[model samples]
Target: MAEKAESLDLIWEVTEIARLIGRTERQTFHMLQSGQLPAKKVGGRWVAERGTLIRFFMETAA
Candidate 1:
């Protein structure tokens, strides 16, 4: 059977964002709640846009 590929345009869930940033899901949630991170509610779930996250990291690093 062939493996399924992930969609690049799909929004990332909190756990995935946590893994990407090396943080816990709770920490990611806190950041979202505190407005330190940008996210949107879609279908009752919080999701972060990949481009927004990349820009946020770039701005913070500078």
Candidate 2:
């Protein structure tokens, strides 16, 4: 489905990132604010690359 392609995007919003990692937006925002996730704030919005998140979780899961 086209929905799956969202994960292939280079930039993702907090909600998207939350879904990717199977967490809630509140939790994802906390992780981003605490520097637990590799991301940056641009134009007052949180953004992250799907690949980076995937690899980060993959590595952490090991």
Candidate 3:
């Protein structure tokens, strides 16, 4: 289905981002709190769009 394909494309929740960056959920939350990671609060959950996350990585890498 279209929705399923979209979901598979690219999306990162705090847990996923933590796993990708080899950190704990608590650490990831700290990054969010410190304004190091690009995320948006949606329905009481933090989420990073794929593009924003990639951009954040690139910028921070520099």
Candidate 4:
């Protein structure tokens, strides 16, 4: 039997969030550190819930 790949319910790294927001990884990290973006540390990695990112865009777009 073959193992199935895990399905991710959220983004758990700055690089992934950067790609989603069209920003550089370094920029994402800066935002995270400055509290300009929403994220939480899980298992030693920073993660952002998908809904949170979408809400951020909606709020900022308004």
Could you estimate the TM-score for every candidate? 0.71, 0.80, 0.66, 0.78
- How well is each residue in 1-62 modelled by candidate 1, as lDDT tens digits? 22323433445688887776678999988997788887776777778767678788889999
Q: Sort by lDDT, best first: what order?
A: 2, 4, 3, 1
Output the TM-score of candidate 2. 0.80
Error of 1 at 28 (Å): 0.2
Residue pairs in candidate 1 whose N, alpha carbon or C atoms collide under 3 angstroms? none
Q: Which is better, 1 or 3, measured by TM-score? A: 1
Better of 3 and 4 by lDDT: 4
TM-score of 1: 0.71
Give the root-mean-square deviation of each candidate in angstroms.
5.7, 5.5, 3.7, 5.2
In model 4, which regions exceed 4 Å deviation? 1-8
lDDT of 4 by residue, 1-62 (tens): 22322443588799998988789999999998898888887787889877788789789999
lDDT of 2 by residue, 1-62 (tens): 78876555666589888998899999999999999998999988888887888999999999
- Candidate 2, after superposition: displacement of residue 30 in Å? 0.5
Residue pairs whose backbone atoms clash in candidate 2: none
RMSD score of candidate 4 (Å): 5.2
lDDT scores for all predictions?
Answer: 0.75, 0.87, 0.76, 0.83
